[model samples]
Target chain A: MLDVADVHTYYGEGYVLQGVSLTVEPASIVAVLGRNGVGKTTLIRTVIAFTPARRGRVMFEDRDITRWPSYRIAKAGMGLVPQGRRIFPSLSVRENLEIAQRAAATDIAEPWSLGRVLDLFPALAERLRNGAGTLSGGEQQMLTVARALVGNPRLLLMDEPTEGLSPHIVAEMKKLVVGLRARGMAILLVEQNLAFALDVADRVHVMDKGKIVFGGTPAELDADETIKKTYLGV
Target chain B: MTFWIINTLNGLSLAMILFLLAAGLTLIFGLMHIINMAHGSFYLLGGYIAITAIRLTGGFIFGAIVAVIAIAVIGAIIQRLFLARLYKQEMRQALLTLGLLFIVADIAFFTWGGDPLLVPQPPLLQGAVHFWGIVYPLYRVFLIGCGLVIAFCLWAFLERTTLGAIVRAGMDDEEMVRGLGINVPLVFTGIFALGAALAALGGVLGGPLLGMFPGADFEVVLLAFVVVTVGGLGSIRGAFLGSLLVGLVDNFGNAWFPQLSLFTIFVPMVIVLALKPTGLMGRV
Candidate 1:
C-alpha cells in the first residue's frame, strides 16, 4: 500500500501540486482521475519520488519515504511505468527486461519473467531483438508495462498507460491491468479515460487543480454526475 | 615491403594506446554527458603517481597497480563530491571540470617541477626484439598486448555482465534506470572510477612514449577528444575502431606524407561528420 499526505510539489518556481493527498490499499488498484493537466502526472511522479515533494509525507507500507531518492523508492518495491513509454530505444526487449530485474522482496515468486512478459505481449516476443524505437506505438506501450512487471514491483504506478495507444491495445492493456490486480499486485493508476477508470479501479479519487476533489468507489463516482461534470468535465 | 611492414606494426601499436585512453573518455562522456575535461588530468596524475611508486617500490608491476587503485579512488571521490551535482548541465560541467584540470595540472607542476621525469623500464621489458626481421620496441609490443587484453575485457564487461547491462540501460535512459531501483550514484561512481583507472593505466603504459612533461596533459587530452569526436562519443566499440583509424592515420600520415599528417587526422573526422554528423557511435 502507498500513502501520500498533504504533499506539495513544484516545478522550478511554480507550485504544481498543492497539498495533494491520496492512498492505495494493498493489492488494490486506485485510479486518480482528472481532466487534462490537472496535475495527474505530477501526483504520480511525487508518489514515486521522481519529483520529490517540497512539503508533506509519502509513506510506502508505513515507511516515511518523503525524501527517498527515486532509485531507492523503486528498490523499496515500487515500479513506475512513467508517463511516456520511456523504453531505451536502442535496447532490445530482452535487454530492457534484463535491466529492470532486481532481487527485491516483491521480485520473488513472480510469474512475470522475460518469458512471461513475452507471453503477455506475444508481439513483443516476435520482436525480441528489434530496436524498441521501431516497435509500433501499441507495442511500445506493452513493452513499457512488461518492463515494469519484470522488475517485480510490489506497487506499480502507471501514468496514462493507455495514452496514445490504439483502441485494441488500450483494451488489451485494460485486460492486462485487471489480470495484474487479480494476481494481487497493488497499482496506482493515473488516467484521463473515465470509462476505463470506472471499469478497472476498485476505488476512484478525482483530482482537480492539485487537490483530490472526490474519493469513493467507482459506482459512487459514476452516480455523481455533478462531481464528474465539474471536476472531471465528463 | 619491409618499410611497409614496419609502418603497419608501428601504426597498430599506436592504435592500441589511443584505444586505452579514448575508451575511458568516451564511456565517461556517453553515460554522464559530462565533458570531463579533467580526465586527462587523471591520466597525468596516473603517470606521476606511477613514477613515484616505481621509484619507491622499485618494481614496474607494483607501481602500476598502486597508481591505478589510487587514481580510481580519487576519481570516485571527485565524482561523488563534485561532478555528481552538475549532471545534465553541459556548460557548468565543462567549466567545472576544466577548473579541476587546471588545479591538478598546477599541482603536478609544483610537485614534479617543469622537467620531463625519467621513467626507466623494468629490466625484463627494457630490450627490443627482432620480429619478422624488423626491430621493434619491447614496450610498444607490451602496450599493444595490454591494449588488446584490456579492450577484450571491457567488451566482455559490457556484453556479458549484469552490471554492464545496467550501464548500457543507464546510457540509454538514466531516468528509466533510476526508476527501476538502480542506485544511479553508485553506478556513476563505479563507472567514473573504471574510466579513471583505464586512463591511469594508459598513462603509465604510454608514459615512456609521452614522457611526463608540463603540457603532456593538454596534448593527450586533445588527442583523446579528437578520438572521441572522430569515433562518435560514448561508443566503446566506436572508441576501439576509431582509435585504430586515428592511430593508423596519424602514424601512416606522418611517415608517408609528413606535411599532411595533422590534416590526415581531421580528414576522416570531416568525412564522418559529413555523413553521420553524430560521429560513428553517438546516439544523440
Candidate 2:
C-alpha cells in the first residue's frame, strides 16, 4: 500500500504538484487521469523520490519514505516504468533485464523469474541477445515493462505506459496490467487515455492544475460527464 | 625505414602512457561530469610513491600496486567526502578539485623534495629486442603491451559483464538506473576510484621513461586533456585513438620540426574539433 498526503513538488522554480493527495491500496490499480501538464508525471516522480516532494509525506507499506534516495525508494518495493521507454540503447535486451532483476519483497507471493518473465513476453525471449534499441516500439515497451517487472516491486509506478503505443499494444498493456494486479502487485498508473484508465482502474482520480479534482469508482466516473470533459477533455 | 620504425615505436610507447592517464579522466567525465583537476596531481603523487616503494621494496610490481591502491583509496575518500555533496555542481566541483590539485602538488614537493627520479625497470624487461636490424627498448614494448592488456580488459569488462551493463546504463540514464534499485552513489564512488587508480598506474608506468619531475605533472596533464578532447570525452576507444594520434604527432614534430613542436598536437586537435566538434569517436 502507498499513501501520498498533501504532496507538494517543484521543478526548479515551477511548482508542479501543489498539495495533491492520492492513495493506492495493495493489489489494486489506482488511475490518475488528467490532460497534459497537470502534474501527473510529477506526481509519479514525487512518490518515487525522483523529483522529490518539497512538503508532505509519502508512505509505502506503512513506512515513511518521503526523503529517501531514489535507489533506496526503489529497493523498498517501488519500481518505475518511466514515461519514455528509456531502455539502455546499447545494452542487449538480456542485459537490460539482468541489470534490473532483483528479489521480490517478502509480501509478494509469486516473484518474477527471468524464465517466467520470458513466458509472459515470448517475443522478448527470442530477442534477448539483440540490442534493446533494435526492438520495435511494442517490443521496446514490453522490454520496459519487463525490465521493471524483473525488479520485483510490490508497488509499480507506471507513467503513461501506453503513450506512443499502437492500439493493439495498448490493449495488450491493459491485459498485462490486469494480469499483474491478479498476481497481487499494486500499480499506480498515470494516464492521459481516459477510456483505457477507466476500463482497468478500480478507482479513478481526475487531476487538473496540480490537484485532484474528481474521485470515485469507474461507474461513478462514467456517470459524471462534466468532471470528465473539464479535466480529461473526453 | 629504420628511422620510421624507431619513431613509431617511441610514439606508440608514449601513447600507451597517455592512454592510461586519459582513459580514467574521460570515464569520470563521462559518468559524473566532474572535471577532476586533481587527476594530474594524483599522477604526480603516484610516481613519487612508486619510486619510493620501488626503492624500499626492491620490486617494480609492488611499487605499481601500492601506487594504484593508494590512489584508489584516496579517490574513494574524496568522492565520499566531497563529490557526493557536489553532484551536478560542475563549477563548484572544478574549483574544489583545482584547489586539491595545488594542495597535492605542494604535498608532493614537500615530501619528495622536487627531485627527478627514474622508476627502476624489472630485470626481466631491461634489455632491447633485435629484429631485422631494428633496435627497440624492451621496456617501451612492455609499456605498449601493458596498455593493450589494460585496454582489452576494460573493453571486455564493459561489454561482457553485468556490472558493466549497469555502468553503461548509468552513463546513458542515471534516473533509470536508480529506479531499478541499484546503488548509484556506490557506483559513483567505485568509478571515481577506478579512474584515479588508472591515472596512478599511468604515473608508475611513465616514470621510467618520462622520469618523475616537479613540473612534469602539469605538462603531461595538458597532453592527457588534449587526448581526451581530440578523441572525444567519455569514450575509451576515443581516448586510445586520440592518444596514439597525439603521441605520434608530438614525437614526429619534436624530431623533425623542433621549432613547432608545441603546436603539432594542438594543430591536429583544433582541426578535429573544427571538423567533428565532438572528437573522432565521441557520442556527443
Candidate 3:
C-alpha cells in the first residue's frame, strides 16, 4: 500500500537517511529494526513528509506524495504514532481523541469508530475528562495508538511503540499490534525490541548507518546470526 | 460610600471593554504565536467605520455589526496575504505587523481627521439607572452586560464544541494537531479573523465612553499588553481578572491619587510578575 523509493533525508547538513528504499504491502506489518541513530525514525518522518525526502519519491495507493505537506500526507490515509507519545498535555483525553477523528480518505469498509477504540482501551474511556499528561506511561501509549486509529488510516507508522514500557505492557502492545494487523491495517513499525518486532511483523528490514543492510522473513533474520550481530546488535 | 460605588461602577465599565480587547489579543497570540502589533489598529479602524456606518444607517447596532464584519474581512485578507508566509518567523511577523500599525495610523489620521469624535450611546441606552442610592448611566450597564454575555459565549464555545477542542489542542501542540490531518492554516486564519472581530466589537462598544481620538489606538493597545502580561499570555479567565484589576486601579488612582495614577495601574502587574514570572495562569 506504500512505496518509499530511494529516499534520502537530512537533519540540517547531516545525511540521516541515505538512499533507503522499502515497501509496505496491503494488510502487512513491515518492521524496521536498528540500533540508535540508525535513521529508523528518520525513515518514518520522511514517509510522512515531516522531514521530506530531499532526493526520493514516496507513493501511497499509487499516488506520488513526495512533495505534499505533512498534513496532506496524513490526510491521504497515513497516521503516525510519533516517538514519546506526543499527546497534547493540556487537553483532556476525550479532546485528544476527538481532534484525531477524521473521515477516512478512502472507502475502507467498517472503518474505526470512537466506540471501537474506547472498547480496545477501556482505561481511556474511564478517564475521558482527565488531562492527557496525567495518564500513566502505559495508558499514554495506548492513547497514542488510539489517537492514530481514530483517523481510520490505511497505513500506520509507529516509532518505538514498546519503548520504556514494562514487560507486561510491552506484551499487551505486541498483542495490540497483532490485532491491528488482523483487522487489515498496514503498519511500518520501527523498533529496538527484536522479539516484539519478529513476533508481529510479516517482513523485517534491518537498517544500519542510514541504509537497509538486510531484508527477509523474520525466520530468515533469526537464522542470519552475522547480520543480526553486526547491524542490530542482537 | 457614594463616591466608592460610582468609582467601582466606572471601573467595571472600563474593565469590560479592556476584557474584550485583551481576550482577542491573547487568543491570537496563544494560537498563532504571532505578536500582531497591528491588532490595535483594528480597534481604531472599527471605531472609524462604526461612526461612518452609524451616520449612513442611522442606527447604533447596525453600525457596530457592519464594523465588526468589515474588520473581520480585513483581518482575513491580511492574514492570508501577509502573515501566512511569515509563520514561525516571529521577528519578521512582529516587524511586519508594526509596519502595519504605522500605516493604519496614518490612514486613520488622513481619513477621519485628527479631532476626537464623540460616539453617542444608542438611543435605548441614553438615560441613567438608579442603584444603591446612586445614579449610573444605562449605557455603562449595557456595556457590562455585553462583556458578561460575550464572556459566557466565548467560554462555552471554547469548552463545548469540537472545533473549540481542536483550537485548545492546537494551542498546546500545533505540530501534533497538524499531524492528525487537521488543516491548521485554515484554523489560524479563522482565529485571526475572530480575534479581529472581537477587537472591533470592543472599539465600537467603548468609543462612546473613551472617545475616538488620534492616539486612542496606541493608548488602548498599551493597556491591552499590560492586561495580557499581568493576566498570563493565553488564559481568558486571566484576562478577565486582569482587566478588572487594571480598571479598578486606574479609576481609583485617578480619583484619589491623580499624581500616582500612571504608576498605580502598573503596581499589580509588577507584583504579579515578581511572584510568577509567567503571569497568573500561564503554562510556561
Candidate 4:
C-alpha cells in the first residue's frame, strides 16, 4: 500500500537516508531495525514528509505523495506515532483524543473510535480528565498510540514504539502492534529492539549508516549472524 | 468612604478594558509565539473606524460591530501575508509588526486627525446610576459587565470546545498536531483573527472612557505588555487577574497617593516576577 523508491534524505549537511527503498503491502507490518543513528528515524520521517525526501518518490495507495506537506499526507491516511511520545502536556487526555478526532480520515469503514481506543487502553479511559503530563511513561506511550489510532489512518508510521518501556509494557506494545495488523492496518515500525521487532514484524529490513543492508523474514534475519553483527551490533 | 468606593469602581472599569486588550494579547502570544507589536494598532484603528461608523450609521452597536469585523479582516491579512513567513524568527516578526504599528498609526493620524476624539456612549448607558449615596457612570458599569461576559466566553471556548482543544494542543506541540492531520496554519489564521476581533471590541468599548488619540495605541499596548508579563506570558486566566491588579493599583494609587501611582503599578509586577518568574499561572 506504500512504496518508497531510493529515497534520499539529509539533516542539514549530514546525509541521513541514502538511496533507501522499501515497501509495505496492505495489512502487513514492515519493521525497520538498526542501532542508534542508523537513519531508521529518518526513514520514518521521510515517509511522513516531516523530512521531505531530497531524492526519489513516495507513493501511497497508487498516488505520488512525495511533495505533500506533512498535514496533507496525514489527512490522506497516514497516522504518525512520532518518537518520544509527544503528547500535549497541558491538555487533558480527553482533549488530546478529541483533537485527533477532528482530523480523522472519515472514509475508512469502521474507523477506530474513541470507544474502541479506550477498550484497547482502559487506563486512558479512567484518566480521561487528567492532565496528559501527569501520565506515567507507559500510559503516555499508550496515549500516543491511541492518539494515532483515533486519526483512523489506513497506514501507521510508528517510530520506536517500545522505547524506554518496561518488559510488561513492551509486551503489551507488541500485542497492540499484532492486534492492529490483524485488523488490516498497515504499519511501518522503526525499532531498535530485536526481539520485539521479530515478534511483531511480518517483514524485516536491517538498516546501516544510511541504507538498508539486509531484508528478509524475521527468522532469516535472526539466523544471519554476520549481517546482525555488522549492522545491528547484535 | 464614598471617595474610596468611587475610585474602586473607576479602577474596575479601567481594569475591564485592560482585560479585554490583554486577553487577546495573551492568546495570540500563547498559541503563535508571535510578539505582534502592532496589535494595539488594531485597537486604535477599531476606535477610529467605530467613530466614523457611528457618525454614518447613527447606532453605537452597529458601529462597534463594523469596526470589529474590519480589524479582524485586517489582522487575518497581515498574519497571512507577513507574520506567516517569519515563524520562529522573533526578531523579524518584531521588526515587521513594529513597522506595521508605525504605518497603521500614521494612517489613523491622517484619517482621524491629531486630536483625541470621544466615542458616543450608547443611549441606554448614557446616564449615571446612583447607589448608596454614590454615583457611577452607567456606561462604565456596562463595560465591566462586558469584560465579565467576554472572560467567561473565552474561558469556555479555550477549555470546552474541540477547536479550542486543537488550539491548546497546538500551543504545546504544533508539529505533533500537524502530524495528526490538523491544518495548523488555518488554525493560526483563525486565532489571529479572533484575537484581533477581541482587541477591536475592546477599542470600541473603551473609546468612550479612554478617548482615542494618536498615542493611545502605544499607551494601551504598553499596558498590555505589562499585563501579559505580570500574568505569565500565555495564560489567559493570568491575564485576567493581572489586568484587575494593574487596574486597581493604577486607579487607587492615583487616588490615594498620586506621587506613587506609577511606582505602585510596577510594584505588584516586580513582586510577582520575583516570586514566580513564570507569572501566576504560566507553565515552564
Candidate 5:
C-alpha cells in the first residue's frame, strides 16, 4: 500500500504539485485523471520521489520515504513505468529486462519473473535479442510494462502508460492491469484518457491546477455530470 | 622487406600501449560522461609508483601489482570524496578533474625529479626472441598480448554479462537505471577503479618503451584523446580500432615525416569528425 498526503513539489521556484493526496490499496488500481499539464504526471513523480515534495509525507508500507533518493525509494518496492517508455534503445530487449530483474518477493506465491512477464507479452519474447529501438511503438510500450514487472515491486506507478498507444494495444493494457491486480500487485495509474481511466480504475480522482478536484468510485464519477463538465470538459 | 616487417612490429607494439591507455579513458567517458583530466595524471603516477615498487622489491611483478592496486584505490577514493557530489554535473566534474590533473602532475614532478626513468622489464620478460631469423624484444610481444587479451575480455564483459548490461543501460538512461533499484553509485565507483587500474597497467607496460618523465602525461593523453575521438566514445571496438589507426600512423609518421608527426596522429581524428562526428562505432 502507498499513501501520499499534502505533498507540495516544485521545480526551482515553479510550484508543480500543490497539497496533493492519494492512496493506492493493495491489489487495486487507483488512477489520477486530468487533461494535459494538470499535474497528473507530477503526482506520480512526487509519490515516487523522482521530484521529492518540499512539504508533505509519503508512506510506503508504513515507512516515511519522503526526501529519500529515487533509487532507495525504488529498492523499497516502488517500480515506476515512467512516461515516454524510456527503454535503453541501444540494448537488446533481453538486456533491458535483465537489467531491471530482481529476486522475487518471498510473500508472493506466484512472483513475477522474466519468463512469466514474457508469457504475458509474447511479442516481446519474439524480439528478445533484437535492439529495443527496433521495436514498434506498441511493442515498446509492452516492453516498458514488462520491464517494470520484472523488477518484482510491491507497487507500480504507471505514468500515462496508454499514451500514444493504439486502441487495440490499449485494450491489451487494460487486461494486463487487471491480471496484475489478480496476482496481488498495487498500481497507481496517471492518465489523460478519461474513458480508459474510468474503465480500469476502481477509484478515480480528477486533478486540476495541481489539486485533486474530485474523487470517487468510477460509478459515482459517471453519475456526476457537473464535475465532468467543469474540470474534465467531457 | 625486413625493414617493413620491423616497422610493422613497432607499430603493433605502440598500438597496444595506446589501446591500454585509451581503453580506460573511453570507458570512463562512456559510462560516467566525465572527461577525467586526471586520467593522464594517473598514468604518470602509475609509472612512477611501479618504478619505485620495482626498485624496492627488485621485481617487475611487484611493481605492476602495486601500481594497479594503488591507483585503483586512489581513483575509488577520489570518486567517493569529490566526484560523487558532482554527479550528473559533467562540466563541473570535468573542471574538478582538470584541477586534479595539475595537482597530481606537480606531485609526481616533485617526487620523481626531472630525470626520465625507463621502466625496467620483468626478469621473465626480459631479453629478445628470434623467430625465422628475425629478432624482437620479448617485452613488446607481452605488451601486445596483454592488450589483445584485455580487448577481448572488455568486449565480452560489455556484450555478455548482466552487470555489463546494467552498465550499457546506465549509459543510455542513468535515472531509469537507478529507478530499477540498482545502486548505481557503487557501480560507478567500481568502474572508476577498473578504468584507473587499466591506465596504471598501461603505465607499467609502457615504462621501458616510453619512459616516465615530467609532462609525459600530456603527451600520452593527447594521443589517447585522438584515439577516443577517432574510434568513438563508449565503444570498446571503437577504442581498439582507433588505437590501431593512431598507433600505426604515429609510428609511420615519426619515421617518414618526423616534422609532421603530431599532424599524423591528429589528421585521422579531424577527418573522422568531419565525416562522422560520432566516431567509428559510437552508439551515443
Candidate 6:
C-alpha cells in the first residue's frame, strides 16, 4: 500500500500538483483518469521522487519515504514505467530486462524473474537479441512493463502503459494488468484509456487540475456519465 | 613500405591514447550528461601522481597503482562535490568543469615547476625490438598492449557484469533507472571515478612519450574532444574507431605534410560530421 498526501509539485516556477492526496490499498489496481496535462504524470513522478514533492508526505508500507531519493524509493519496492517507453535503444530486448533486474528481499511468489517476464511477454523472448528500439510500439510497451516487473516491485506505478498502441495490444495490456492484480501486485495506474481503466481498475480516482475530483468503484464511475463526459470526455 | 609501417605503428600508438581518453569521456558524458572539461586534468594529474609515486616507491607497478587509486578518489570527490550539483545542464557543467581544469593545472604547476617533467620508463620495458629493422621504443609498444588490454577489460566490464548493466540502463534513461531500484547517483559517481581513473592511466602511460607539462592537459583535451566528436557523442565503439582514424590521419598528416598537419587533424571530424553526423558507429 502507498499513501501520498498534500503533495505539491512544480515545473520551474509554475505549480503543477497543488496539494493532491490519494491512497492505494494492498493488491489493488487504482486508476487515475485525467485529461491531457492535468498533472497525472506529475503525481506519479512525485510519488517515485523523480520530481520530489515540494510540500507533502509519501508513505509506503507505514514508512515515511517523502525525503527518500528515487533509487531508495525504488529499493523500498516501487517500480515505475514512465510516460514514454524509455527503453535502452541500443541495448537488446534481453539486455533491457536484465538491466533493471534486482533481487530484493520481498520478491513475490512465482516472482517476476527474467524467464517469467519473457514468458509473460513472449514477443520479447522472440526478439531477445534485437535492439529494444527496433521493437514495435506494442512490443516496446510490453518490454517497458517487463523491464519494471523484472525489478520485483511491491508497488508498480504505470503511467499510460497502453498509450499509442493498437486495439489488440491494448486488450493484451488490459489482460496483463488484470493478471498482475490477480497475482497480488499493487498498481497505481495513470491512464487516459477510459474503457480500459474501467475494465481493469477496482477503484477509480478521476483527477482534474491536480486534485482528485472523483474516487469510487469502477461501476460508480461508469454510472456517472455526466462526470465522465465532463472530465474524461468519453 | 617501411615508412608506411612506421607511420601505421605511430598511428596505432596515437589511436590507443586517444581511445583511452575518449572512452572515459564518452561514458562519463553520455551516462551523466556532465561535460567535464577537467577530464584531461585528471589525465595530467595522473601523470604527476605517477611521477611522484615512482620517486617515492622506486617501483613502476606500485607507483602506477598509487597514482590510479589517488586520482580515482579525487574523481569521486569532484563528482560528489561539484559535478553532481550541475547535472542535466551542459552549459553550467561545462563552465564549472572548465574552471576546474584551470584550477587543477595551476595546482600542478605550483607543485611541480613549469618545466617539462620527464617520466622514466620502467627498466623491464626500456629495451627495443626491431620491427622491419626500425627501432621502436619498448615503452611505446608496452603502451599499445596496455591500451588494448584496458579496452578489452572495459568492454568486458560493460557487457558481462551487473554493475555494467546498471550503467547501460542509466545511460538509456537515468530517471527510469532510478525508479527501478538501482542507486543511480552512486552509479554516476562510480562511473565518473572509473572514467577519470582510465584517463589518468592513459596520462601516466603516455607521459614518457609526451612529456608532462602545464599545457599538455589542453593538448590532450583537444585531441579527446576531436576523437569523441568524430566517433559520435556517447558511442564507445564510435570513439574507438574515430580514435584510430584521427590517430592515423594525424600521424600521416604530420609526416606527409607537416605544414598542413595541424589543420589536417580537424578534417576527419569535419568530414565525419558532415557525412554521418551521428558518427561512423553512433546511434541516433
User: Could you give candidate 1's per-residue lDDT for residues B146-199 as a string of tens digits?
Assistant: 899999999899877778878888888887799998898899999999999988
Can you tell me which runs of candidate 2 are displaced by over 4 Å? none
Q: Backbone clashes in each candidate structure, one number apiece?
A: 0, 0, 0, 0, 0, 0
DockQ category of candidate 5: high
Interface RMSD to the true structure, each candidate: 1.2, 0.6, 1.0, 0.7, 1.0, 1.3
TM-score for candidate 2, please give it.
0.97
Q: Is the docking of candidate 1 incorrect, acceptable, medium or high quality?
A: medium
Model 3, range B156-254, lDDT digits (tens) per residue? 888888898888888888877888989999999999999899889889999999978788888898888888888888778878888888989899989
TM-score of each: 0.94, 0.97, 0.97, 0.96, 0.97, 0.96
Model 2 chain A weakest 10-residue run by lDDT: A104-113
Candidate 6 structure quality by residue, lDDT tens digits, B43-106: 8999998999999888888877888899899999999998888778789989998999999999
Q: lDDT per residue, candidate 5, B1-284, as tens digits? A: 76677777888888888888888888888889999888888889999999999999998988999999999999999999999999879999999998998898889989999899988988898888898789999988888888899889988998999998888888888888988888889989988888888888888999889999999888888888889889999888999999999988888888899999888878878999999999998866
Off by over 4 Å in 3: none
Instruction: Give every collision pair in model 1.
Output: none
Question: What lDDT is reached at residue B214 by model 3?
Answer: 86
Which stretches of model 1 miss by more than 4 angstroms? Answer: A104-112, A115-119, A230-233, B256-262
The alpha-carbon lDDT assigned to residue A15 of candidate 6 equals 89
Q: What lDDT, from 0 to 1, does candidate 3 have?
A: 0.90
| List of chain A TM-scores, every candidate | 0.96, 0.98, 0.98, 0.97, 0.98, 0.97
Cα lDDT tens digits, model 6, A152-224, are: 8888999999899999999898888888888888999999999889999999999899888999999999999
lDDT of 4 by residue, A1-234 (tens): 999999999988999999999999988999999999989999988998888999999999999999998888898888899899999998999988888873445455677889989999999999999999999999999999999998888899999998999999999998888888888899999999999999999999999999999999999999999998988887
Deviation from native of the Cα of residue A149 in model 5, angstroms:
1.1
Q: What's model 2's lDDT at B45?
A: 76
Q: What lDDT tens digits, residue by residue, belong to model 1 across residues A12-60?
A: 9978899988888877899999998889999988887878999999999
- The CA lDDT at B260 in model 4 is 87
